[model samples]
Each structure stands twice: as C-alpha cells, then as structure tokens.
Target: MSKAYVFTRNGGPEVEALVDRDMPTPGPGELLVAVRAAGVNPVDWKLRKGYTRPGSVPQPFPTVFGSEAAGVVEAIGPGVGGFAIGDEVFGNPVAGGYAEHTLLPVAVTAHKPAGISFADAAVLPVAAATAYDGVRQLGLAPGATLLVTGAGGGVGSAAVQLAQHAGVRVIGVASASKKAFVESLGAVHVEPGGGLADRVRALAPGGIDAVFDLAGGDTLREAALLLADPAALISAGDKQLVAELGGAPVERARTAAVLVAVAGLVVAGALRTHVTGTYPLSAAGEALRAVEDGHALGKTVIEVTV
Candidate 1:
C-alpha cells in the first residue's frame, strides 16, 4: 500500500489525515512517480478549505493534497512518450501529490535536470511557472521598472528574480524582516502598509512602468494607481479585483516547454529555488501551516521518504 496525506472532506485541518491506500496505476499518458518531494503553497490550504480553482471539476472525497511534486518514474502508462522508467522528472501531478506514489501527466511533466534537486524542481510547477507567465505577460523591456507586492512570498520571490533577469528593475514590497532577502533577488525592497503608493512614488518619481501584484485586496487596489496605463497592471493574486481595476489576470501557460525553460534556468544559475524549509511527509500538516500562516521565507517543501 502507498501512504498518502489527504483530506477526507472539504474543510479545515480537522479534515486531514494520513493513511495507507493501494497505489494508483498510471492512466494513459500518465507516469507513476515515486514522490521524493512536494512543494507547499497557499493554494494548497485554500483548496483544503473548499476553495476551487475557477472551472476546475469537483474532486472526490478523501482527495489527495498536492499538485506539485518531483520524483523518479516507476512506470509509464500506455500512449505516453518521451519518459521512461527510472528517469527523474518533475511537474504537475495528475492528482494530489502528497503521497508515496503519484501519477503525473506527460503533457506537463519535464525531465529533471541533473543539476536540479528534487526539492527545487517540486517548487517550479506552481510558483516559478506562475512567475514566468506573469512576467512574460507584462512584457516589460530593459530599464523598465515593475512594482511587485507580496515580494517575499514564493511566487513573488520568483517574480522578482525573473523580472530582474529580464533586465527590468524590480521594486519589491514585503515586510521589513524580508528586506535583505528581497534585495538578494536584485529588487529594491519596500515595506508594505499605509501610504504605500506614496512610498513607492518616493523611490520612482517617474512612475512605475508596471505593477505585478501578488497580494490582493487593499494592497492590489492601492498599487493599481501607480500605473499610467491600467493595462500595465496585472495580478496572480485576485482575478476579480484585477478585472475591476481594468487589468487582466496573469495568463498562465502551464506547458512542458515552460517547465523545461525553468529547469534550464536553474542549471544556468539564473534562477534559484530557495527552499527555506522542508518537512517529512509525516509532518505535512506542519508544512502546510507554515505556508498558510504566511511566515514561510522563500518556499517550504515536503520531503517524502518512500
């Protein structure tokens, strides 16, 4: 039997449990992966509390708890190509990822680079990939300045680095405690809160070229005023708020090509998957708490011993 951390119903932590179940066989175009690591994100807990992604089909009861993981391929389903048994791979899993074994769809999976660790690759699918999509959608040029709120979180941290790599100057707004960390990503750090727009204007008198908001609600509403063209504002935070402000949500292209590019960037030393903390599969609840509490530094990953 394969062990997995799962929630039996839609609710809070009370619904979560760890149990042993029969290992799932790979479906057509799927790969059975021996999960080595799983990445934790805010959306994981949100989904645990019954929040569904727009238009996502309803999941069954006793659902697994993760979507991003990296591990070795144990078997490939019929009709799948470009992957083989014993090959290391990472990307979006077919179902939940917090398990001893999980199935991965071939369409989104990419072979793990030798230089990248399973822990790091586990973080790319949701966080780093979103960062790549958001920055590319903005299409800021060299010398352009982009203001990013929630600059210290997982997706925000990746956005900061990706934007800087694209030759755009990034002004990262996070907490004072993360000033040094955000700066290390090559962004000018600004503490968020009251008078944030004034503070941002103090740094960029010419006005910010674009706004990439990772924090929703007031932070997003306030930052939208900084952009001259409303279209320059984009978000991965809240689609409703972004639309109300005349800006669109970050366009996500969850493709194998993007995953390959991110892995390539890691190999080239251009991108760093800063995993700040790791917990064993037994401690999945604690790991989720770290992210849900909003205190996780860069990224938190669950190391599955299987």
Candidate 2:
C-alpha cells in the first residue's frame, strides 16, 4: 500500500487526512513514479476548498493535494516511449503528488537534469513554467521595464528573476516584509497596498513597459493603469479582471518541451528555483499551510522518504 495525504471531501484543512491505499497503475502513455518530492502551491488548499481549474475533470473523494512532483520511474504504461525504469523525472501529476506514488503523463513530463535536485525540479513544472510562459507572452525586450506584482511568492519571484535575466529592468511589488527578498532578484522593491501606482511611478517615471501580474483584484487594477497599451498587460492571477481591463491572460504552453526548456535554464544558471522550505511527507499539512498562509518566501516542497 502507498501512503498519501489527501482530502476526504471539499472543505477546509479539517477534511485532510493521511491514508493508505493501493499503488496506482499507469494508464497508456503514463508513468508510475515513486514520488521523492512534491511542490506545494496556493492552488492545493484552494482545491481543497473546491476550486477547480477551467475544463478540469471533476475529481472524486479522497483526492490527493499536489500538482507537481519529482521521482524515479517505477513502471511504464503501454504505448509510452523514450523513458525507462529507474530514470529520474518530474512533471505535473495525474491525480495528485502528495503521495508515495503517482502517475505522470508523458506528454507533460521531462527527464530531471543531473544538476538540479529533486526538490528544486519538483517546483519547476508549476511556478517556473508559469513564469516562463508569462514572460515570453509579454515579449519585453532588453532595457524594457517590467513590473511584477506579488513578487515574493513562487511564481512572482521566478518571474522577477527571469525578467532580470533577460536584461529587463523590473520593479517588484510585494509586502514590506519581502522588500529585501524581492530586491535580491534584481528588482526595485515597492510594497503593496494604498497608492501602489504612485509608488511604482516613483520608480519608473517613463511608465512601465509591461505588467506581469500574479496578484489579482485591486493590485492588478492598480498595475493596469501603468501600461500605455493594455495589450502589454498580462496576468496569471485574475483572468476575468485582466480581460475586463482589455488585457489577456498569460498563455500557457503546457508541454514537455516547455518543461525541458525551464529545466535547462535552471541547469544553465540563468534561473534559480529558490525553493525556500522543504517538509517530509508526514508533514505535508505544514507544507501546505506555509503556502496557503500567503507568507511563504519562495517555494515550499514536500520531500518524500522512500
């Protein structure tokens, strides 16, 4: 039996429990992985509260609570190609990642690079990949100034670093507590809340070339005013608000090729995963709480002991 941290029903943390179940068998084009690490994100707890991604199939009771993981391949399903038993890999999971084992679709999975740790690789599939997609979608050139909201969280931090690496000047908006942390990613730090647009204008008088928003609602609305062309505004946080402001949601290329590219960037030292905390599988709830609390500095990952 494989042990998994799961939510028995849609609710709050009270619905969560650790239980044992039979290991899953991979379907065609899937791989059964012995999970070594799982990345925690805000979406995990949100899902427990019954949040569903657009077009996602409804999951049943006792659902696992993670989106990405890294581990060794234990069994390969029929019709899968280019992967072998015992090969290290990481990607978005089939059901959930907070378990001793899970299934990974070959289409979104990628081989783990030797230079990247399982904990770091575990996070790339979600946060880093989203950053890549958002940055590329904005298509800002070097010397261009970009503003990133919620710059202290996983996706925001990665987005700041990626923009800086591309030679784009970045102004990062986060809490006052994260000032140093945001500036460490090569961005000028501006605390969020009241007069946000005025503070950002203080940093870039010529106006921001683009806005990469990870904080939605009021924060997004404030940043939207900074852009001359609303087409330069893109968001991963509030899609509906973005559209209402005449901006588009960040276009995601959820492909293994994209995963491979992000991993290569990590290996090449152009991007840092910056995983700030790790918890054992037994402490998965604590890990989720760290992210769900909205105070986590970088990325939080659950390291599963074999």
Candidate 3:
C-alpha cells in the first residue's frame, strides 16, 4: 500500500485527508514514480474546490492534490522508451503528485539533471515552465520593460527572473510584503491594487513593452492599459479577462522539450526555483494551505520519504 494526501470530494480543506491506497500501476507511455518531492500550487486547492482545467477530465473522488513531482522511476509502462528503472526524473503527474507514488506520462517527463534537486525539479513543470512560455511569447527585446503582476508568487517570481535574465527590465507588482523579494529577482517592485498602472508608469516612464500577468482581474486590466498594443499582453491567471482585453493567454508548450529547456536554465544558474517552503508528505495540508492562503513567497513542495 502507498499513502497519499487526497480530497475525498469537491469542497474546501474539510474534504482533504491523508489516506492509504494500493500502489498505482502505470499504463502505456507512463512511469510509476516513487515521489521524492511534490510541488504545491494554487491549482491543487482550486481543483479540490472543483475547478477543472479546460478539456481535462476530473479525477474521481479521493483524488491526489498536486500537479508536479520529482522522483526515481520505479517502473516503466509498456511502449515507453528512453527511460529505465531507478533513473531520476520529474514532470507533470498522471494522477496527483501528493503521494508516495504516482504516474507520470512520458510525453511530459524529463530526466533530472545532476545539478537540480528534487524540490527544484518538482516545480519546473508548472511554475517555471509557465514563466518560460509567457516570457517567450511576449518576445520582449533587451532593454524593453515588462510588467509582471503577482510577482511575489511562484510563477510571477520565476517570470521576473527569467525576463531579467533575458536583459529585459521588469517591473514587478506584488503585495508590499514581497517588495524586497521581488526586487531580489532584479525587478523594480510596485505594490498591487488600486492605482497600479500609475505607479508602474512612474517606474517606467518610457512605457511597458509587454505585460506578463500572473495576477488577473483588475490587476491584469490595469497592466493592460500600460501597453500601447494590447497584443503585447499575455496572462496565465485570468485567461478570459485577457482575451476580452484583446490579449491572448500564455501559449503553453507543454512538452518534454520545454521542460528540458527550463531545467537547463536552472542548471545554468539562469533561473532559480526560489523554493521558500517544504513539507513532508505527512504535512502536505500545510503546504497546500500556504499556497492557497495567497501569501507564499515562492514555491512550496511536499518531500516524500519512502
């Protein structure tokens, strides 16, 4: 039997529990991973509250609560090639990542580099990859200024760093508490909420070349106004709002190639996971709570020992 932290039904934290279950078996093109670490994100709790990704079938009850993980391949399913048992790897999970074991589809999985730790690799598939795609989609040139809302959070923080690494000047909008944190990523920090655009204007009078929005709704709206061409705007947070504003959602290239690229960036010191918190699998709930509470400084991971 394997232990997993799961939600029995769609609801709040009340529905979540740590339970024992049979070991999972990987199907064709999948690998059963002995999870060493699982990254926590807002989507975990959002899914527990019944938010489904577009076109993704909902997992049945007692569903696991994570999106990405890193571990050794315990077993490889039929038809899967280029991987062997005991190889270290990380990727988006087939089930959920918050478990002793879970399945990872080969299409999204990548071999873990020696330089990256399990905690850092666990977050690359989601947070770092999203940042990678959004920054590339904007195609901002060096010396161009990019505005990143919610810059203190996982994706936001990664975006800020990646953009700066590309020689783009980044103005990060986050809570006052994360000012130092955002600035540490080399972004000019701007507080969020009312008057966001004006403050950003004050920071980059020449104007914002693009907006990579991780904070949606009004924050996205305000940032959109900073761009002379709405086509320069892209969002990972509020897709609908961005579309209505004449901008597009971040075009996610969810492939092993993209994962490899982001992992390489981490290895080269061009990107940092900025993992701020880690919990054992037994304390998965607290890890989820930290992200769901909307104040987690960076990535949170659940480290599983087996």
Each model's C-alpha lDDT?
0.93, 0.94, 0.93
**TM-score per candidate, chains pooled:** 0.99, 0.99, 0.99
**Relative to the unseen true structure, what is the C-alpha lDDT of residue 293 in candidate 1, on a scale of 0 to 100?**
89
Task: Decide which is better by lDDT, 1 or 2.
Answer: 2
Per-residue lDDT tens digits for candidate 3, residues 1-306, read 999999999999999999999999999999999999999998899899988899999788889889899999999999999999999999999989999999999999999999999999999999999999999999888999989998999999999989999999999998999989998988889998889889888888899899999889989998999988999999999989999999999999999999999999999999999999999999889999899999899899999987
What lDDT score goes with residue 230 in model 2?
A: 96
Against the true structure, whose lDDT is highest?
A: 2
Q: Mark the regions of model 3 whose C-alpha exceeds 4 Å error after superposition.
A: none
- Number of clashes in model 1? 1
The digit string of per-residue lDDT tens for model 2 on 208-236 reads 99999999999999999888899999999
| Candidate 3 accuracy as lDDT | 0.93
Candidate 2: which stretches are off by over 4 Å? none
Candidate 3, pairs of clashing residues: none
